[model samples]
Target chain A: MLKFTEDHEWVRVEGEIGTVGISDYAQEQLGDVVFVELPDIGKTIAKGDEAAVVESVKAASEVYAPVEGEVTQVNEALNDNPGLINSDAQGDGWFLKIKVTDASQLEALMDEAAYKAYVEGLG
Target chain B: MSQDHDVQDLKRTPLHGLHLSLGGKMVPFAGYDMPVQYPSGILKEHLHTRDAAGLFDVSHMGQAALVGPDVAAALETLVPGDIQALGHGRMRYTQLTNEAGGILDDLMVTKLADDRLWLVVNAACKVNDFALIEGALDGRASLERAEDRALLALQGPKAADVLSRLAPDAATLPFMTMAELDVAGTPALVSRSGYTGEDGYEISVAADDAEDLAKLLLAQDAVAPIGLGARDSLRLEAGLCLYGHDIDEATTPVEAALVWSISKRRRAEGGFPGAETIQRQLADGPQRRRVGIRPDGKAPAREGTPIMKDGQAIGTVTSGGFGPTVSGPVAMGYVETAHAAADTEIDLEVRGKALPGRTAKLPFVPQRYYRG
Candidate 1:
C-alpha cells in the first residue's frame, strides 16, 4: 500500500521494506528537475527529518523522511537522469529504499483518496 | 484587518489584470504582486523570448525627468557617468556612488533635451534613488517623479519588426537612443534599449493608457507577454547585473566590471562622487571582482554558494541559476582578484558538496543588441 505525507513525499510498503519518492504533484510544482542529492545508503533517519534535496532550474527543495527507518539503497541512475522525477516521480524515480523502524507509523499517513482531497484543498 | 491591510499594501501595476488573464503565476516581488511566470512556465518563456519578441510590463520601475538649464551638470555630482556630454536622444548606463566608492544604485540616464534628462532605476531602489537625486539636485535642478507614467519593454530579435509597425520611426533609432513617438494613438517615449541583450525598445506611456498600449502590442503576432521569471533568466544569460544581487552599496563599478560605462572623460576629470576611490581602483585592480561562473555539472550553484579555491573559501555566488539558452547552469559572483580571471578553475559549495566550475567571460550567449 502507498501512503503520502503532508510534505508531499510518498512511500510504498512491502513487508518491512518501503520505497520512498516525492509525489507527482510535488514534481510538477518543482518544474524541471535538474539535480537531486540522495541520502547515503545505511544512514538512519527519523520521521520528518530532511533526507534529500531536489534542485530545479529556479530553486531547490528539501524532501523529508515520512517514516523512521534505515536507508538500504538509493536510485543511482538519478545522478545522470534527474528528469526521471518529472517523468516518473512515483515509480522509476524512487529516491530510496529503507527498512521501516515502526509499522504503526504508516497508519498516520494519508491514503491515495485522502491525499487527492488534501492536494485539492491546497489549490 | 491586518491581513487585509497586508494585501492592500502590495502595489499593483497597470497591467496586473492582463497578467492574470494570461494565466500568470503571481508572487510578491519588491513589494509588488508581479507575475513570475505564466502557464507556459519559465523554461518555455525564456526560450521564447530568445527566439521571438517578448513584451514585459516594467511599470514598477521608477521613472523621472530632471529639468533645469544645468540639469546634466547637477546630475553628474551624484553619478559617475558623463551626463554633461550626453547628446540629445542618447542614453548612458551609470551608477550612483558613495564616499567609499560603493555603488548606491545602477540606472540609465537619457538626454531628452539640453535642459531635460530622463532616468529609469530599479524597482526595489526607486524610493531611495528618487530621494537621493532630489536631495542632491534640489537647488540646481527640479526632479519630477513620473509616477503617472508606465514603462513596458518589447524585447527579442523580432521586437523591432513588431514595434516598427506602430511607430515607423522607432526602427531608425540606434541602440541607446530614444525618441518621442506615438504608439497606437498614444504619445510615448521610446528607447532602443533594454535589460535583455536582444534588440528591443522600452516605451514609457501615460499610466491610464498603459493597458490600451499593451493590448495593441499583444495583438502583434510576433509578441507574447513575458513574466519576471523569463526576464531574470534572460538578463542573467546576457551577463547583466541585477542591482541588489550582483551589485549593491558595497560594490564599486570598477569591481563590478562596469568600467566601460564610465566614459573616458569621466575617468580623467573625476568629479563624480567616490571619484578618488574609483580612480584608484581604475589605476590599480580592485580587491574583488565580479565574473561569470560555469558549473561543470547539471546542478546549479545558487546564490550564497561559497566559491572555494583549494579548500579555501574565496567568494560567494550572488546570482546563479540554469540558463535555458545555454542548456546548462550559469552564474555570476564576486571572487577574490586572484580567482577572477577567465578560465580559472574553482569549486562551488552546493548543499555541502563541492562542484567543479570555471570562470568564464560574460554573456554566456552573445549579445544581439541592434547597435545601428
Candidate 2:
C-alpha cells in the first residue's frame, strides 16, 4: 500500500519494510535537485524526524521520516545523479528503505486516493 | 489582519502586470512585490541569460538627481568615489560610507549635463540612503527624487545587439558611460553597464512608458524577461557584491574586497566619510577579507553557514548557492585574512556536518564585460 505525509514524502509498504521518496509535486516545487544527503544504514529515527536533505539550486529542504524505523538502505545512485528525484520522484528516486518497527504507525498516514485530494487542496 | 496588511503594503513596479502575464512567480523582495522567477524557472532563465539577453525590471531601485553648481563637490563628502572628476556621461561605482569606514550602501553615480548628478541606489537602502544624502548635502546641493522614473536592464552578451536596433547612439557608449537618447521613441538615460558581469545596458525611462519600452525590447529575438531569481544567480556567478548581502553598514569596502572602486585620487585626498579608517585599511589590510568558497561536494553552503579552519570557526558565508554556468556550488564570505588566500582548504558547516571547501578566486565564471 502507498501512503503519503503532509511533508510531501510518500512511502510504499510491503510486510515489514517501507520504501520512501518525495512526491512529484514536491520535486516540481523544489526545482532542480542538485544534491541529496542520505541517512546512514542502521540509523534509528522517530516518525517525523529529518531523514535526508534535498538541495536545489537556490535552497535546501529536509525530508522527514514518515514512520519510525531503522534505515536499512539508501539510494546510493542519488550521490552521482541527484536529478533522478526530478525525473522519477515517485519510483526510481526512492530515497531510502527502512525496517518498519511499528506497522500501526502507517495507519495514521494518507492513502493514495486521500493523498491525491490533499495535493489538490493545496492548489 | 497584519499579514493581509503586509501583503497590501508591498510596492509594485511599472512592469507588475506584464510580469503576471508572463507567469512570473512574484515574491516579496525589499518591500516590493517582485518576480523571483518566471515560468522557465531560475536554472533555465540563468542559462538563457548567459547565452542571450535578459531584460530586467529594476524600477524598484531609487533614482534621484542632484542639481547644484557644487553637486559633485557636495556629494564627495558622503561617498568615497571621485565624483568631482567624473566627466559628463561617465558613471562610477561607489559606496556610501559611515564614520567607522563601514559601507551603508553601494550606488552608481553618473555625471549628467549642467551641474547635475544622477544617482541610482539599492532598493532596500534607498530610504535611508536618500535621507543621508539629503541631510548631508542640504545647503550645498538639492536632491530631487525621481520616483516617477522606471529603471530597466538589458543584460547578456547580445544586449548591445538588441538595444542598438532601437537606439543607434547607445552602441557608441562605452562601458561605464551614460547618454540621453530616445529608445523606441521614449526618452531615456541609458548606461552601458549592469550588475551582471556581461555586456549590457541599464536604461532609466519614464514610469508611464516603461511597459511599452519593455515590450519593444522583448520583441527582439534574443531578449527574454528575466526575474530576480536569475538576476541573483547571474550576479553571484559574476562575483558582484549585493549591497545588503555581501556588504552592509557593518562591512568596510576594503574588507569587502572593493578597493578598486575607490579611485587613486580619492584614496590620496582622503576627504570622504570614514576616509581615515579606509586609508588605514587600504595601507595595512583588514583583519578579515571577502573571498570566494567552492565546496567539494554538490551541496551548497548557504548564508550563515560557519566556515571552519582546523576545527575552529573562522568565518560565515554571506551569499552562497549553486552556480549554473560553473555547474557547481559557489559562495562568497568574509574570512580571517590568514584563510582568504585562493585554493586554501577550509570546511563549511552545513546541517551539522562539515563539508570540505576551498577558497577560490572571485567570479566563479570569468567576467565578459564590453569595455569598448
Candidate 3:
C-alpha cells in the first residue's frame, strides 16, 4: 500500500517496513537534483521530522518523514547520483526504509487517487 | 487580495511571450516575472553558455543616460571610479557609495560622447538610484531614464560568430566598448561586455523590437535562450558580485575585494561620496576581505551559512551554490583578512555541521574574456 502526505512525501508499506521518497510532482517542482543528505540508519524519527535533504540547482528542500519510524536503511546510490529523484522519483529514487513504529499514522495520509486530486487542487 | 496584488505588481518583459513559448519556468525576480530556467534545466543551460552561446533577456535591468556639458566630472562626484579618463566608446564598472563608505549599488557607466554618458544599473536598485542621482545632480546633469528600452545579453565563446551573422561589425568590437549600430535592421546600442566571464555583447534595443530581435538571434545554430538560473551560476563561477548578495549597503569596495574598480587617480584625488572613509581604508586596510571558497564536499554552503575557522565564527557566505563548470560547490564571502588568502583552511557550517573547505582564489573557472 502507498500513502502520500500533503508535503509531497510518499511511503510504500511492505510488511512492517516502508520505503519513503518524494512524489513525482515534488521532483518536477525542484528541477535537477544536485545533492541529497540521507538520514543515518538506526535513527528514530517522529512523524513529520526532517529526515533528509534534497538539493537542486536552485535551492535546497527538506524531505520530512511522513510517519514515525526507525531508519533501517538509506539509499546509498543517491550519494553519487542524486538526480535519480528527478529521473525516477517513485522507484529507484526511494530515499530510505524505516521500520514503521506507528503504522496507524499511515491511515491519516492520502492514497494515490487522493494524492493526485490533492496536487491538482494545489494548482 | 495580497496574492492578487503581488501578481498585479509583477512587470513583464518584452520577451515574456517568447519565454512561455519556449517552456520557461517563470518566477518572480526583482518584482518582475522572469524565467529562472527552461525545459533544458540550469546545468545544461550553464554548460551550454560556457561551451557555445547563450541568449539572456535582461530587459528588466535599468537603463538611462546622463546629459550635460561636464557629465563625467559631475557623475564622478557619486562614484570612486575615474570617469574623466574614459575615452569615447569605453565603459567602467563602478559602485555608487553612500556617505558612510558603504555601497549603494554597483553600475556600469559608458562614455557615449563628450556630453552624454550611458548608465546601466541593477533592476532592483534602479528606482532609488535614479532618484538619488536626480536629487544629487541638481541640474548639473539631467537624468534621462530609459524605461522603454529593453536589454539583452548574448554570451559565450560562440557569441561573436552568432552575433556577427547579424552585424558583421560585432566581430571586431573590443571588450568593454559600446557602439550604436543597426543590428538586423533594428537600431541598437551594443556593448562588448557582459556579467559572464565570456566574450559577449549586451544589446540595448527599443522595447517594441525586443521580441523580434531575440527571435532573430535565437534562430542561430549555436544560440539558445538562457534563464536567470544559469546566468547566476555563470556569474558565480566567474567570481562576479551580485549587487545585493556579494555587496550591499553594509559592504564597501575594499571589503568586497573590488578596490581595483576604484581608479588610482580617484584614490588620490578623493572627491566622491564616502571619499574620507574609502581613502582611509585604501591607506590602511579593510577589516575583512572577500574571497572565493570551495567546499571539499558536495554540500553547498548557501547564503547566511556561517564560516568557521578553528571552532570560532570568522565570517558568513553571501553567495554560494553548485558550480556546473567547477563540478562542485563554490561560494564567496567576506572573512577576516588574515584568513582571506587563497588556500587558507576554513570550515563552512551548513545545516549545523562544519564542512571542511578552503579559501580558493577568485574565478573558480578561468576567465575566457576575448580582449581582441
Candidate 4:
C-alpha cells in the first residue's frame, strides 16, 4: 500500500522494503528535476526528516523521509537521469529503498484516499 | 488568518491577477510577487524566445530620473561610465561602485535630454541605489522616483519586426539607443536594449497603462508573456550577471568580467568613486576572474557549490542552470586566475559529490544581439 506526507513525499510498502520518492504533484510543482542528491545506502533516517534534496532550474526542495528506516538501496540512475521523476515519478523515479524498522510509523502517514484529499485541500 | 496575512504581504505587480489567471506559479523574487513560470514551464519559455519572441514583464525593476542643469556631471560622480558623452536618447550600462572598488549595483542610464537622465536599476538594490544616488547628487540633481511607471520587454529574433507594428520608428533605432514613441496610441519611452542576448525593445509606460500595453503586445501571434523563471534561465544563457548572485558588493567590474562597461575616457579621467582602486585593478588584472563552467554531466552545480582544482577548493559557482539552448548544464563562477582559462579542468562539489567541470566560454549559447 502507498502512504504520503503533507510535504508531498510518498512511500510504498511491500513487506519490510519500502520505496520512497516525491509524489506526482510535487514533481509537477518542481517543473523539471535537474538534480537529485541521494543519501548513502546505509544512512538511517527518521520519519518526516529531510533525507535528500531535489533541484529544478528555478528552485530547490528537500525530499523528506515518509517513515523511519535504514536506506538499503538508492536509485543511482538518477545521477544522469533526474527527469525520470517528472516522467515517471512514482515508479522509475523512486528515490531510495529502505528497510522499514518500525511498521507502526506507517500509521502516521496518509493513505492513498487521505493523501488525495490532503493534496486537494492544499489546492 | 496569520498565514493569509503573510501571503498578502508578498509584494505583487500590477499584473499579478493576470499572471495567476494564465496559470503562473507565483514566487517571491527581489521583494516582489512574481511568476516563476507558466504551464509551458521554464524550459519551453526559454526555448521559445531563442526560436521566436518572448514578452517579459519587468515592471518591478526600479525606474527613476535625474533632472538638473548638469545631470550628466552629477551622475558621473556615482558611476564610472562616461555619462557626459552620452548623446540624447543614448544609453550606457554602468555600475555604481563603493570606495574599495566593489560594485554596489550595475544599472542602465540614458540621456533623454540635456538635463534629464533616465535610470533603471535592479529591483532588489533599488532602495540602497536610490539613497546613494540621492546622497551623491544632493545639490546638483533632483531625483524623481517613477514608482508609477511599468517596464515591459519584448525580446527575440522577431522582436523588432513585431514591435515595429506598434511603433514604426522603433525598428530603426540601433542597439543601446532610446526614443519616446507611441505604441498602439499609448506614449512610451522605448529602449533598444535588453537582458536576453536577442534583438529587442524595452518599453516604459505609466503603471495604469501596463495591462493594456501588455495585452496589446501579447495580441501579436509571435509574442508570449514569459515570467521570472524563464528570465533567469534566458539571462544565464546570455552570460549576463544577476546582481546578488553573479556579482555583489564584494566583486569589482574587472573581477566580474564587466570591464568593458568602464570606458577608455572614464578610465583616463578617473573622477568616479573607487576610481583609484578600479583603475589599479584595470592596470593590473584582477586576482580572481569570472568564467563560464560546463559540468560534464546533467547534475547542475548551483550557486555556492564549491569549485575545486586538484582536490583543493578554489571558488564557488555564482549562477548555474540547465541551458536549454546549449542543451547542457552551464554555470559561471570566480576561479583563480590560473584556472580561469578556457578548457581548464575543475571539479564542482555538488551536495558533497565532486562532479568534473570545465572552464568554458560564456554565452554558453551563442548570443545573437542585433548589431545592425
Interface RMSD for each of the candidates: 5.2, 4.4, 4.0, 4.1
lDDT of 2 by residue, B209-258 (tens): 99999999999999999989889889998999998889998999999999
Residue lDDT tens for model 1, B169-207: 888889999999988689999999998899999999999
**TM-score of each model, in listed order:** 0.94, 0.96, 0.98, 0.93
Q: Between the candidate structures 3 and 4, which one is better when assessed by lDDT?
A: 3
Model 2, C-alpha of A62: deviation from truth (Å): 0.7
lDDT of 1 at B1: 3
- For B1-372, candidate 3 gives per-residue lDDT tens digits of 001236567999999999999999888899899999999999899999999999999999999999999999999999998888999999999999998889999999999999999999999999999999989998899999999999999999999999998999999999999999789999999999998899899999999999999999999999999999999999999999999999999999999999999888999999998999889989999889999999999998898889999999999999999999998899999999889889999999999899999999999998887777
lDDT of 4 by residue, B78-168 (tens): 8999999999899999999998878899999999999999999999999999998998888999999999999999999989888999899
In candidate 3, the residue pairs with backbone N, CA or C atoms under 3 Å apart (3 or more residues apart, or in different chains) clash, namely none
In model 3 chain B, the worst 10-residue window by lDDT is B1-10
**Candidate fnat values, all:** 0.28, 0.44, 0.52, 0.48
- How close to the true structure is residue B288 of candidate 2, measured as C-alpha lDDT? 97
Model 1 clash tally, residue pairs: 0
| lDDT of every model, 2 decimals | 0.91, 0.91, 0.94, 0.89
lDDT of 4 by residue, A1-123 (tens): 899988889999999999999889889988977778889889999887878899888667888898999999999999878889998998899999999999999998899899899877776
Cα lDDT, model 1, residue B295: 98
Candidate 4 lDDT score at position B204: 96
Minimum summed lDDT over a 10-residue window in model 4 chain B is located at B1-10
Residue-wise lDDT of candidate 2 within A1-123, one digit each (tens)? 999998899999998889999999898778778888999999998999999999887788999999999999999999998889998999999999999989999999999899889888876
Best lDDT goes to which candidate? 3
Sort by TM-score, best first: 3, 2, 1, 4
lDDT of 1 by residue, A8-54 (tens): 99999999999999999998787778788899999999999988899
Point out where model 2 deviates above 4 Å: B1-6
